[model samples]
Target: MPIDIKQFKEASRPLSERVLGFLKDHPEQAYSLMELMAELEGKADAASMAWIVAIERMSGKKEGSATLNKYSKALEELLKQGKVTEAQLQGTTYYAYGGGHP
Candidate 1:
């Protein structure tokens, strides 16, 4: 079945599940960390930025574990499940939500 962000948003699912649903629903759009967090949580701050960075690292960006620890567990789960992918564009990394190519 196809994923639907509206449906997931209306449900009582966890934040991580909603995030996955959003990614699945828009598999073609590339989302940077800030963009994803702003869209998902309405505001981006230290905690959210750290989570994004962690997810970026988990997506295999050239970064160490220190910055990736203690946050972004939801995205880490998605990465483990192979539901998300990363791409480098103009020297910046962006994440897309889908099983296909990034």
Candidate 2:
């Protein structure tokens, strides 16, 4: 049988929620890959970003990024959608939630 859209959405929900939740809780923190994974309670793999992207894809989410550039693009889209916000720090950029562009 074909997969149901609701099931797919449900599976991807946790990944998206975890990511957004992390940014929301740590608006001022500049998290590296390791730190991000730890905050998400995900495996601290060197390829944690890639792994998360893959998992998201498998769950039927259109957001998948195996590289920093792709991740940034995806996050930018999320920001535009008002699901997240961007912050500038020492010439660097960060993502946060609840429209708090700190």
Candidate 3:
């Protein structure tokens, strides 16, 4: 199932909630930030205008170095809240919902 970021945004939910819901809905799969972005935007590429807008709204960073930076912040917030956990493999981070610490 494809997700629509715009719809979530329009629903007046915070980005973190949207993200958590996505992860919760797919508890068995781990996702990278870009993969999560792609899934949220319903696109293969994470650089689309829709993605940029959605990310900006989520991060409140008007001029960030990169979307990944903001996304990382959101992911870190989730980690702190215990809504998500991450695993590092070969210097790459993968995030998943639940299962406590990764």
Return the top candidate by TM-score.
Answer: 3
RMSD of each: 9.4, 8.0, 6.5
Q: Could you give candidate 1's per-residue lDDT for residues 1-102 as a string of tens digits?
A: 975887555555665676776787887788765566656655556467657567667886565543333225667766777777777889766777867332
**How much is the lDDT of residue 34 in candidate 2?**
35
Q: Arrange candidates by TM-score, descending.
A: 3, 1, 2
Q: Which candidate gets the maximum lDDT versus the true structure?
A: 3
TM-score of each: 0.54, 0.41, 0.65
Q: Positional deviation of 68 in candidate 1, in angstroms?
A: 9.9
> Per-residue lDDT for 43 in model 3?
74
- In candidate 2, position 26 carries an lDDT of 71
Q: Comparing 1 and 2 by TM-score, which wins? A: 1
Between which residue pairs do clashes occur in model 2? none
What are the lDDT scores of the predictions, listed in order?
A: 0.64, 0.57, 0.73
Candidate 1 vs 3: which has more lDDT: 3
Model 1: colliding residue pairs: none
Candidate 2 regions exceeding 4 Å error are: 1-11, 14-17, 25-38, 41-65, 99-102
Tens-place lDDT digits, model 2, residues 13-88? 6455656666777766555443455445445663765566566668765544444444455465666678775556
